[model samples]
Target: MRQDTEVRTFRDGPSPATRRRVLAGGALAAGLGGVGAAASEARTAEVGGVRHGTVRADGVDVFYREAGRPDAPVFLLLHGFANSSFYFRHLMPRLADRFRLIAPDLPSFGFTVVPDDRGYVYDFASLSRTVGAFVDALGLRRYLLYTFDYGAPVGWDLALAHPERIAGIVSQNGNAYLEGLGEAAWAPLRAYWAKPNAAAVESIRARMTLDGVKAPYFHGVPDPSVIEPESYTLDAAILARPGNADRQVTLKLDYKRNLERYPLIQAYFRERRPKLLAVWGRNDLFFIPPGAEAFRRDIPDARVRFLDTGHFALETNGDDIAREIRDFF
Candidate 1:
């Protein structure tokens, strides 16, 4: 059993090297429109000492970013809505020296290519299965999980399915409690959920635009100027793909399924008692701070820390988050 440790707060700005790599990656992605040639360049660039590649998993070309020594303890990073492994560009390099970090872009979100003939369903279960296959393809028997936004449910599904494989979990705004659902932030989604009609679809569809993609990054952030345009720009470009918007809509609806399984996830936390570190952005418009606090309900020892940022916490607080992970683990 891991020994208990006091939580230490870190407030340093991202290192110059980390900033340069992030800007370089954003520039490359923005220049290449965030996919196809851009992804190709990322595969070979080794930006920020991180390597990008793809592996065949569940019949999809899963694009992922990897760093750190191969023999070190693995940290599988699962991203959330409208973002990809690109979101981890800063956090990866910071911890690469100490732990093996792998961040994969899920289907419909990042550079992962899903063939038209595969007839993929953009739901949580299907998404989880693909990630599971990706894990199998990599032969990862045990590893820690770093889940954010949509990643929370996906990681929870993996843990529930194979409790033995998960060494611990680092949930960064990855919600698993009912109270975590911020009513106002999720109003649009809730309206759609209540009535899956054309109007409801249109309401959620508004979020697919470039401005919509940028909203979360600025919300709850202390200094909006610090947030980079490349991050949301890349997300917007990929989301503008021919069929990706509709797939995103399908995913929004399927999120209800994740909420339904909250009890089961909490039960896992109670029974398995996996080491949990909930580092949250208190001002997040979507998943609120209570969600982080709720983790302690099931696992009393679960560490819950809140940052002064919003939904995309890493955009403004990458250094602090990386430090917390290092100290906690």
Candidate 2:
């Protein structure tokens, strides 16, 4: 389904003119009525062709955003840290006509709810299991996996477990190589991994603030003004939930496990030889450009494309990335 590549607003209440004016004035924070208001509005109903729903999976309520026809080839979009399926709000609609897009909020992020009694472990392996349960509950037998940030480890885990289920992979700033680790930006995480002391944990927790949430979105973008403020604002609001900070800290510590699994993931790449596409943000400080280039070492035919954006490439280059996926697939 082709969509007009004009400035479009996702909310139902705002007129196009009013939305444009509000965006121009840089008052979206006020117009969005803070985090509570923005998240509440998003939860109320579907916007554009995207529909929101929840399914019980592995004792956790897995919330997801879905679009496109039920029978279309599946595109399982797994988001990164501090983000939910909401991150795909723009890109899903753009590709809904061609692919069945399903972006699920992992157990800890977004709208997914974990009961206090469930005692869910906030680690990559557990998260991958929950996502596997989610996929089974949805009856998705085969799909094209889209991995970013934290999603890389989870998606790779799935691929390693059930190699027959994945049709292909699209890695957007999803690093699987040690060389891809950006030492400067990852100092705090590395420090936490080295020592899970109070100071180390506090350093990682400090990034849960509003400014820290905004950092990845603004870091390498040539024009920060084009970024929608609601993106980070909503993430900050979600991170502020009670007990959420500790959950994130736990995940940060467990990230070392993902690093350890890099060799195994590379083996999967060589043996399975799944169709792969790496669309990277050249300026991403967390996952460098070499991460994208490394995919070619295992699968010589893998396609890699770099966009002049920051960590969140879809935020700035959604249309271009969408076009690339359509052409490559």
Candidate 3:
């Protein structure tokens, strides 16, 4: 086995020159809009009509992307670290036709506003509670949960808190297994958690740049030209907001709490046996295939698929993932 620190470092990312090239190039063929004008118009005409809103939930102004018809089955999309509801921009448009897609930018991430009073904790437990308040604020009785990366813990906690409210679960590179957090990939964060000194903080912050944000989308893809550079560029700008970096590192250090609850999360899966569909990226270096396969251990009927992509599978296989979700529901 590779030593804990032997995993590759993300410190070295694409330079500014490369990002400038991508933005100026034809790689953004799709742009932020969908395929063609007709398709884009049709997508916008979907039920919820891709509305953006902010609601006061648990003392924070939680920003969310609401699309599809309210009467349709609810599909709650929870994003991961270094990103916000914007992560689901591509998938939301596609699924909005059938399901009620709601993607929120958690506090301290996107446009969501968290007060400086320090009244709330930044750990997963508190974040999970905030998510619960957001769900209840929207009166979501039962909804499909789409969890990715950081979303896994929050969604799982929500399921545990209110089992009757869950319609099903869709996991994309979400981790519920210990083995999913490969040591090499987590070394820096682990170091931070252990020491939490200035040096440790600097180690993790080094990759919080624009290039680091862009790396995940095209990490293992064969064709890097397909993904739009604007995706990460926008996210990087959000992370650069005042005090957001410290909040992110605090969350990263608190991730150990999520791992501690993994057993309870698995117990819920085995006992409650919620319908599960894991659309994973096989090339994901963090949450590896074993984490996706672990779903089968509890829910025998779980549908698991390993895609030919990286952590952000939707960047390359959004259409495929969307189709699978539609069929699964």
Candidate 4:
């Protein structure tokens, strides 16, 4: 049950379990802070063009937007850390015309609620676990996995573990191995995952922004208005929660540790070797083109499109992205 990008730790408040720790002096990141931006775009979710709302999942209620025939090919869309299913709302229906588009609010984001007081472990492991459960709960044993940003790792793990269950994959700006920019969390999290400080913590928080969200979408596109500010706002709000900054810092720290499990991720690709459609924001300031090349290294049949967008490929390239999914299938 993550919105955890790279990190995977801290459940039941704090768990004594197996993990890796990279650097030191990064834990002091208790302080972090957002944009007025535009309101969230109006997204209409319909089932066969019939308006639909939320869907239920075990131990958590998932608010999702779906459309098209249930019998059609299934396309499951997932967003990044601090992002909700809303990013797909604008794109899912159009794709639903050809396939059953399912986009859900992952555990801690969007309309999905988590009691901060109870301390749900929001990390990559939980994300990977719950996504597999979500498929079983919905009786979707076979479907295309659409992943972006943090969704990459979660979906990758799923595809690796259950290759037969995955029909295909839509890789949109999701991290594969250590492909993204070695930013604040990348180094510090890896270096000081177990032991951290506010200074190192502050560096991680500095990267969050509406512009950062929009930058990726602008990569190949000729227009900038395509960016929806509210989506960035949603991401920013999650960081605003009390102790969230620390949680993010801790999680990122954990993600670096999780990085040590790289051999597993790489081996999964070799073992499963599923067809991957790589849709990327070439100009993505975060996970740039070098990262895009990494996908090709593992999956030989990878078909890549460097969109003029950033991490949220569903926004600017929604129509084309959906079409690409159809082509891959």
Pairs clashing in candidate 2?
none
Residue 310 error, candidate 1, Å: 0.6
Error of 4 at 302 (Å): 1.2
Single out the weakest 10-residue window by summed lDDT for candidate 2.
26-35
Candidate 3 residue spans exceeding 4 A from truth: 1-48, 193-198
Candidate 4 on 1-329: residue-level lDDT in tens?
A: 33222222222211121111100101211111111221122112233452234433444445555554444556778887667777787776666556666676776666665554535677777666766656555556567788887777778777777777677787787767676563632565544566667776666666554554344445555676876777777777766666656665555656754566667867777777777888877766556776766777888878888876655667677888877777776
- Scored by CA lDDT, what does every candidate get? 0.81, 0.80, 0.76, 0.61
Q: What is the per-residue lDDT of model 2 for residues 198-267, given as tens digits with 9 covering 90 to 100?
A: 8877877888999888998999999999899989998999999999988998898888999999999999
Off by over 4 Å in 1: 1-48
Per-residue lDDT over 1-329 for candidate 3, one digit per residue giving the tens place of the 0 to 100 score: 11111111112213344323211222222221222233233333336346666656677667777666444567889999778888888898798777767887887778777767647677888788787877766667677899999999999999989887787899999999987887777888778777767887776776688877787777888788988777788889988887777777788778989988999989999998989999999988789999999899989999999888999888789999999998887
Cα RMSDs, all models:
11.5, 11.8, 12.8, 13.7
TM-score of each: 0.85, 0.85, 0.83, 0.75
Q: TM-score for model 2?
A: 0.85
Runs with alpha carbons beyond 4 Å of true place in candidate 4: 1-58, 115-119, 179-195, 207-222, 241-244
